[model samples]
Target chain A: MVPIYYYLILSAILFSIGVGAFLIKRNIISVFMSIELMLNAVNLTFVAFAHHWHQVSGQIFVFFVMVVAAAEAAVGLAIIIAIFRTRATLDVDRIDLMKL
Target chain B: MHLVLFFIFGGLCVAGALNLLFQRHPINAALSLIVVMSSLAVLYLLLGAEFLAAAQVIVYSGAIMVLFTFVIMLLNAGREDRTHGSKAAYLVGIPGAAALFATLVYIFLSYRTPLGDAGLGNYLVTTTDLSKVLFRDLLLPFEVTSVLILVAVLGAVVLARKEH
Candidate 1:
């Protein structure tokens, strides 16, 4: 079996990439996807640790996280649609209605 | 065998995620995310969380990404326009992220041995065992999530309606 740390390291690299994507991306949808990537990375850690401790709670938490991500996706995309309706653009920089 | 599987799936996930970050179009980025999520599902299976592996594929790569794709299509979102932020990010953001990843890798590597190997025993966690824990111990949170999903349903309907 591969060491648990290997999973941890893989997740770490993923989390960093997610963070980088979140910071650099301008589209609202891409940014939202990056957030999902970060969440997935965290879920990986949760599952790895759950296995390490031989407990079921970590997997359960992962279940909940997935549920939450689903809900967030619904609400978030709705907001994105609303934003597009109003601003006529998906670019994060252009959606600043409060800047005036 | 597991190690080889991990390498292939893990490499695919990293590459897909990088593509997601660099892609100009939102549709392309969304597709890349689907790749990442699907690969993570396989990793979950290898890690002994078989239920999660299935759910990750069903819920994440399937349902959630479909929602994203639907939005991208409905909204007709364009490719991300290049801005001044790109230059600043290329100069500083990439290095900062690399440094953070390096630090994380170093810390985990250094502590891994002292923590000892094989905290995971030979047994793989099964779906039945997982469900028992979920319904028995974590019941409240489970119920709350259902309510949360209900609220999200309402919120999406309310928010997405075309106004007069």
Candidate 2:
């Protein structure tokens, strides 16, 4: 048996890594992957708590999160493609047309 | 047994995440993300969510990652140029993430007594049980996600279509 805190600590570490990568990475696709990593860390926490509480709803919520992630990925990649078409670069720092 | 498996897969997950950060190319980072996703699926199995383990592998590692790789290849994404961006991101972002991680760890450890330990053979959630709750209690959200997926598909097609 592993302590529940272990699962939680691992999730926290993964999430922090995801956040750091999201902030640090210049590539749009890599940034998106970091977002997915954050989502995965949260899903791990949900499953752990679900096991702790003996609730099916937690797992159900994970399913919904996965659903939403899929939809988000589809649209997000499409937008990335559109952005690439215009900018001709995947670097986030350079995609600053909105900056004043 | 469960603890050993947890440590192993959990180590794999962290290693993959670090690889994702250090990798210079988007394709390499994408592959590292697959490693992370697959290891996470194993961890889900450890947590007794068998169906979620399966779903994590299929939906996340199998489908979503493939889409990411396809996009990477389609766009010919290259190795990222290592130019340092604005000073604010480095000064704020790294420390912010570290602070958040430390805070979460401190909170979890301080409340350790209430969390208890998770072991195998305690509450293994099977697919049938999951389906029952999802189909019966969560039917509306389930159906709404279908519409959401439909809308996402239409949006993707429209957004990615060739323009004159």
Best by DockQ: 2
Candidate 2 lDDT, B1-164, residue by residue in tens: 99889989999999999999888799999999999999999999988899999999999999999999999999999988866683567687799999999999999999889999998878899999999988898888889999999999999999999899
- lDDT of model number 2: 0.93
| For model 2 chain B, the run of ten residues with the poorest summed lDDT | B81-90
| TM-score of model number 1 | 0.95
DockQ of each: 0.72, 0.84
Candidate 1: count of backbone clashes, pairs at least 3 residues apart or interchain: 0
Off by over 4 Å in 1: B115-121
What's model 2's lDDT at B128? Answer: 98
**How accurate locally, in lDDT, is each candidate?**
0.89, 0.93
Q: Candidate 1's residue-wise lDDT over B43-86, tens digit each?
A: 88887888999999999999999999999999888888888776
